[model samples]
Target: MDQKKEIKKTNDQIINSFSTELQTKVKTSISIIEEAVARYGYEGLSLSYNGGKDCLIILDLIHSIATGILPTNLTNPEKLKEIVLFYLRDEDDFEEIDEFVNTSLRSYDFRNYTKFATNSLKQGLIYILKEYPKLQGIFLGTRTADLKGRKQPIFAPTNGDWPESIRISPIMEWNYSDIWDYLLTKKVSYCELYDQGYTSLGLKSQTKQNPLLKQKNGEFLPAWVLSQKSSERDGRILSLSNSSTSTQIH
Candidate 1:
């Protein structure tokens, strides 16, 4: 089949598998992207993608809309160099994530392309803005399940100390179960670490598979099986995570 047909097929499969509530959520998220692109005109907007599960969903929606499966009235760039991309790549992050991001970077063309992070997420934001000075906003994959994202509004400005930019979280209302439901049901490709029982990802040295997923067979279940939302970060060394928020999560 041709590319457009294939994209439509994939999109249909994804949408059909979602529950009615989730279907609305997905469409709302798509509309959020449409609104952002309409307001920012793609070039003025940026995508804060880092090969995480949430961002994977964000990217998929963007692809579908851009390809006309979801239909944005605006002219879809045959390639989505329309909106820019940025990621805060740290040397200490997981190799699997970096590999996935690199592979995606090649296809999506969203990199200002830096591999560094200071002691804080705010500093990372500062650097991203400095690199992409013209960007008015960025689409973040942040969800309520993430501690930093719990209180965040769907649309908000950066904190006073952080560099100024609008942070658009399309999936802000989605819960833990909602996330896994969408990813698995859509058959979206995600980072391999998730299959290894990692519910949440942090720096490679500090993060591990969720302890709560351990089974009687000396093996552990995947991230999707973790019963408690609060225990998602049980594998991470909290002290370091408290100091520096991870790029892997968003």
Candidate 2:
């Protein structure tokens, strides 16, 4: 099939698939997390929440489902427990975002990594897990469609450096619209970036305004908009599931 035709087919699928996948992903995520906690007998699990809209949604679902198993729901805005919420930002801007995640959030672990690149979020998590080996599993809000590098996805058995604690992503199949709809329905509080024109939210420097919000061709783009030659992708550092992995193109 031609590349253009494939894009069209996927775009059409995003509409119906968005809602269907959103619910499915949430349920799937819940089941996986519960199973891990039940089998491993963990008191709590850690999440690398980036203070974005999708992260907020993941926190909500985790709180709702994992409460039964772990008895430690970090995402619950009401319980106000101290679960770690990690931030990767420049030293200059850390104060404000830290305050927001702390004061605004009812419960959090409240960890920050300054001087390290945002890509270090993964490495930081690895370090934390290594230090505190009791943590059974980890959760993230990464969806397949959000990252261009993750088109055809494998839900189970996702590989990572921190393999001891099985990695779980509840919203793995959700589309952008599905995220928004779920947020609206659940009334979860998220960062205000989504309302402002930004499609993919990340560090202040790395994030870009959505190209497709105003144009048809711009939607569903990966969060990182900077284009580089394929050769350069190798040198770039990327983070996923609280672990840093090299992007080596063969």
Candidate 3:
């Protein structure tokens, strides 16, 4: 099979793997995305990709939609040619995460769509917006359980004083387990940190293996084994506390 046909086959497998119930939800999310793209055009939309589990799910969803696995009103092939993918690269990011992001971009044929900024999230976003003023929307992978994500709508309009871009959270209703299920079922490659007990990812200095996942047999469990969604960020907070004390002592 040719590369294009192989890619399409992979996407079809992923989309078909979803349960009937999940498929319904996926369709709804895709519809929301299609509407947004229709309203602003593909050039006017961006995907906020962070190389995290949630963002990975969003990435796959977009791929499925673009390949026509999920329904979409977009008919122009040119609109899909240069769909912008934005990433804010922190200096303290994990090496594994960086590697995964690069590998996935190529593996998923998204190398041409990526835009990287080595600055703080806010600054990176501002820079991108300034560079691409036509961009009016960003597709985020924020779930309701994430920090400051509870109130975000599936199609949130931008604040008047903000960057003048809508923040779209199609998977806002999805939970922790939902994310893992989708990724694993789709045979998606994720950051290696998850296998090392890191439930949630952040700057390397502010993230660590989840202590709760340590077993009495001196073995570590994968992040997806985590039962509580709220505790996913415990490692991050613990790391921050340690960093703060180390700073004070110096």
Candidate 4:
């Protein structure tokens, strides 16, 4: 009982802290983001364009702050230049993410590249380091409220080994409702997945569509597909292929 009380207290304190931080910074987040662009030099900046609502809002803010004079042209729709958009398709869902990105965002620089966050971060760092050595950093749309079982991040991550490029999150203290309010006031165009009941979007194979995920720890995959005929065939073929490859190596 004592331990439970302590845990409850900790959770309350964290929520309070985030509420306070957001109250203080909500008005100034845009200025701070603009300052980052000026301080870092726009030419050295790039956003990790994921084509999600959060990422789209950030990109829009960057454009607003720059007053139409942003350094990089990849994400700029006016430039028609290519920027990498890390995404994967859901074969079972029978819908392409690009169909949404194209019709909604009206852009083509959206490259379908990233399949997972962990792997994408590694590859993004390597690509920047190798291709654009002078690039300063990348911005992410991560928020304190987004983490499932995390202590909200307050400062930049430093102790862990990272690429020379900096990673920043200006809206880290903001919540989902806060973001929605801002989007409404600013009238920014956003991805349509949110209306369809997806809080986060990823590969169709990995992503699930349910708004109650946070409350229920819900399973996204359909139960009917569990023992489907194609999956069974693929399983056998995969096993046989592995065995044959191992025998050849031997």
What is candidate 2's lDDT per residue for 1-250, written digit by digit as tens? Answer: 9965765565344333436655466556556655545544443456655566556666666554433322222244223133334444444332434455555454523332222334454565566566556755555666664455645332333355534554556676666566667666555555554454555444444444554433465444332222332211222233323322311110
Q: Best candidate, lDDT-wise?
A: 1
lDDT of 3 by residue, 1-250 (tens): 9976876777557667887767666767777777878778888888777788887887877776666554456676335536788777766778787788788887767634545546344455577888788888888776676634236577777664556678787887777777787878777889888998988887776677788899998778999999987777777744333321121000
Clashes of 1: 0
Measured with C-alpha atoms, the lDDT of residue 51 in candidate 2 is 61
Scored by TM-score, the top model is 1
- Per-residue lDDT tens digits for candidate 1, residues 1-250, read 9986887777677677789889889888977876777677776777767777788778777766766655444566434456666667777888898898788767645434554454355666777777778777788877776645346677788776778888888887777777888878767677888888888776787788888898788688888887797777788766433432445563
Query: Against the unseen true structure, what C-alpha lDDT does each candidate score?
Result: 0.72, 0.47, 0.70, 0.45
How does each model score on TM-score?
0.83, 0.59, 0.82, 0.55
**Better lDDT candidate (1, 4):** 1
Residue 161 shift from truth in candidate 2, angstroms: 6.3
Candidate 4 segments exceeding 4 Å error: 1-26, 68-96, 102-119, 148-161, 211-250
lDDT of 4 by residue, 153-227 (tens): 432442355566665666766655555555554455555554444544554544555424223544333211232
Candidate 2, residue 178: lDDT = 64
